[model samples]
Target: MDANGHVQPYIINKNMGKPMADFAPELPKKNADGVPIVEPTDEQKYMFDADGWLLIPNVLSEGEVEEMREWVKRLHFDPESLPDHERTILAGPTQRLIDHPVVMGMLNEFTANPALSSQECYGFSLGTCGYWYRTAPNRRTEGLKEARAFKPHNGNGLYRLPGDVHFYNSFPGKSFCPHMRVVWELNPVKYKQGGTLLVSGSHKAVYTAPDEIQDPDSDVWTTYECEPGSLLFFAEATTHSAHPWTNEENDRIAVPTLYNQVDGGFAEALKPDEKLLESMPPLRRTLFRDRYVANNVVGADFKRLWRV
Candidate 1:
């Protein structure tokens, strides 16, 4: 098997050896408007394939970080100024975060459906977006806290239908994770301050996870510290959860944007409205288009499937 040069049979052989897809050889390098694409370094790619997540430190400049924070703050504190529905969505320059250079590059390789091309569309869509803020009920815990703001869920090894968008696959020139997540930290995320949680490498596992690993004490759960403006990209196939926000003085302010293949989206309510789509360039607006099957699909039983 020429792992380096050849595409191999991937992922559906009864789990005899569900190899972890090597993510480096086929990362899509796509850029944002006026911004050059930020390709993942070799080490970063290796870490992403191995751990199912990667943190690109300071991907946004200090000034950019400050500006984004201000926008988010307005959305948070000045909710009354904006309608309820608008409060949770990106506003002003923050809307550009959907196709930010760093994020687009990763989405191209990870979630973008290779079946499609950039010439036609991004191959992925912004399924939803939201920010989370929290203040600890009491003093921040010095060690891992048992109380999780959100329970860990969704990983590759777990049982899922083949049609499930949150999937992981690999071959010679590309890897596929039809659904994924990107988190932009507006505030500093310290080691124990709590942001997001993930079970390292769980995305590629073929076996069901045991109850023990879900506990915060498992030591298998991984999180890291980074300055403001850091971007965290991860596969939805990874077992991930929200760690309790323990920073009381400030707040744990983070924006998480979910993405899925262009053919389908996960969050219908967050789908972009007509006016918003009309305002965006044709290409960028593809991120919010409705779900539809492509004109061409080979050997697929369309009628027998998706009866619902």
Candidate 2:
């Protein structure tokens, strides 16, 4: 327990041997032959540079969205049917979102950071991704005080940077963000019906958000009241919070994806089981490769030790 006695979570692991890779050394500053594996257009680059967030609207058709909405329920009901890897393949109607074209392009630029000539991160890879559903008419927010409607998390606060390196801590043009976030809204998120809330431009802010912005009811925070097929993309450094759902008409289904630089830290422990990998096309399987180990096998210029 902390000094305040509030409940906190911690993990204790006995000291093992040295880590398999030391990621502290700066990457090469430039690679003349280094071309981005995925590319974002000029417009996308501008929007993200100006706001730290971008909304790509209606990338999925109505039919595709419906299929994914149903898939969410099926997956939730029987998660064991598919190995963790195949749960979100990049092919087929429901799985197409695993690497939607526009989304990939944007994530590619953010995770690859061509501005630095790909030095910060060689390329982008999946860190973790998951689906969320808020059933309609659910009273998860019934007892909460209006002031507590949303809870904020992440970002540098009060002019002091966050200790976590992957928490979108850099300014707009620094090293490519260690983490890039993408959220696909499979249901309409109407204003105040509760969607993700973000402090617009806060990813680059060195100061804590003011009281007004933190208030759940305050308009100071930006909330995307978007359509079912819209996508929200943001850097991990952006201060963000979950806005509790108050929608009584329909359930809100969202898939939040976290992509990291090929060399960035990842907290997830699950790797794709062999059966899942063998079943995927080479292109799709590439997303699941263990960055360091896979690089060595692929004859990449830079490879790190996966296990000594």
Candidate 3:
């Protein structure tokens, strides 16, 4: 309590320690114009409107990329000792390479950049969970023929079909779970090494042609050729598929991590378990809400302010 007699903002702990309450660090109030003073840059803003992808070149250093490649090679060659899902086994200098300050700093800078709007970074390990081509133990005559033709939809051993291929929608929607994916290519792209194939503007398409309706000669899709250390970011709305590596002798690998704009207000509505939310720091909670809260009034005010 103060001399004015107004109630102070503080919380009492059960252990009887000093009352802890975060009162400072309030976000700047929306201005009279109602437009956020800090908006995304032209290139960042274009991501949401146009192609729905951003390719960052040389995000990882050559040495770091090589270390990741070596790690993947070790994992692939030793089938009996592969790392389980979420279980990481960093060998030799690979562990240090991944945990290097530079790598950590880059990740933090990219994820926390104002252009991304306080988005949460979801990390994925390509070494553990990348899509791979697996052949059946005993190939049938039809399978061999289908493989030779390079058919995209044939359930042959050459290619493993993605579980779902639909337009962007929320979680319940088949394509929603994978809102975004970042590919960290470990190996340098060569002419015929089977890199990921993607349709440049397919993410903007409202409808996807059925498998039976696809034309063999259409140029709707093209393969993504990139160097090691390059990062390819794409939205799940895109019509994309993986090409099989004809060179079985040399393994190709990439790691991907997904992140979404925190300011979009989607994360707040889809809050995980209550326990998890409660455990998070107050600043995180406040920042998340400030960025993600859907303020209908704010939108209306923005329109009136800007006459847009």
Candidate 4:
């Protein structure tokens, strides 16, 4: 209390510097040229850079797919039945995806680019992740193009000028992308089977998406027709929308994990409580631990903004 009996509100928050803990993250492997190394073939990288999306067929084995199917059912049927750690930590078979070998190369490569010259070290952060399910044919309209259709969700709108901040660092020679959405399909995705719609080559387009291309059923928008174990990857800057399930026979279940620059937006994922981390191996626990590298103290030192 002050001399006049006017009470002062306490300011409790203070900058504690970095948290004192053994924080380690899966760092990206870089080549001699300082570009992060990715496992995708030259052609695959070209496809992703040009089209903004890539589909790797049969990343999961038959047995693994079956296991995932059952797990999803168990999770959806009575989620509360599982322990808090399993539910929140995403334990059991699902944990295999924390740094799945099939997709980690590209993820590490894309997430490590620097946003600006001021940044230091290179690293990526895990963003939001969730499951999706669709069944049968729906009555809702399949394809309709409008202004709000599949616009870029992050940063200062979509299209940018030549010298503007480019997310995913889409330069001439070093063409690896920055942000990516990884989707693991548990069931076969045949043509018109209700996969996500993507406007081809929209990721790098300098102009706004046209109404014709924005249409869900537009000829420019393409859908994947791959096996159940297929792994789908697309840059967030790419124009995309959900398409209605037109197969009408089987239910389509998919799990999508979004990984982005720690500096960028869309960082919504369940925090791993002590109990959850305790139950995980050191390697897996690294995924949840916020890293502290000497060069990149600001966290934003890393790269990429999803500017259209």
* Best candidate (score: TM-score): 1
lDDT of 3 at 161: 31
lDDT score of residue 286 within candidate 3: 28
TM-score of 3: 0.46
lDDT of 2 by residue, 1-308 (tens): 43334332221122254432422222222221232233455677777755677887787899888888878766666667865665653323554565566665665445642211223333456777777777544444542233224678665522443446545533433335666788999999888777888777776677766878668778767777888999998776777788777787766788888776554445442256677557554444445555542332222334232233
TM-score per model over all chains: 0.77, 0.70, 0.46, 0.71
Q: For each candidate, what is the lDDT?
A: 0.67, 0.59, 0.39, 0.58
**Structure candidate 1, residue pairs in collision:** none
Better of 1 and 3 by lDDT: 1
Each model's Cα RMSD? 7.4, 12.0, 15.1, 14.2
Q: List where candidate 4 sits over 4 angstroms from the true fold.
A: 1-38, 113-122, 137-166, 268-270, 291-308
> Which digits, one per residue and each the tens of the lDDT, describe model 3 over residues 1-308?
53335343343333355543321111222211232223233464344335545565666788877777766555545544643431232233333332233222222222321222222221111112242222222332232211222344211111223543323432110122224555666666554346655555555554544553253335765555667777666654555555555544344566644433343412222332345436443323322233332332221221221121
- The true-structure Cα RMSD of candidate 1 reads 7.4
lDDT of 2 at 156: 52
> How much is the lDDT of residue 139 in candidate 3?
36
**What is the Cα-based lDDT of residue 261 in candidate 3?**
35
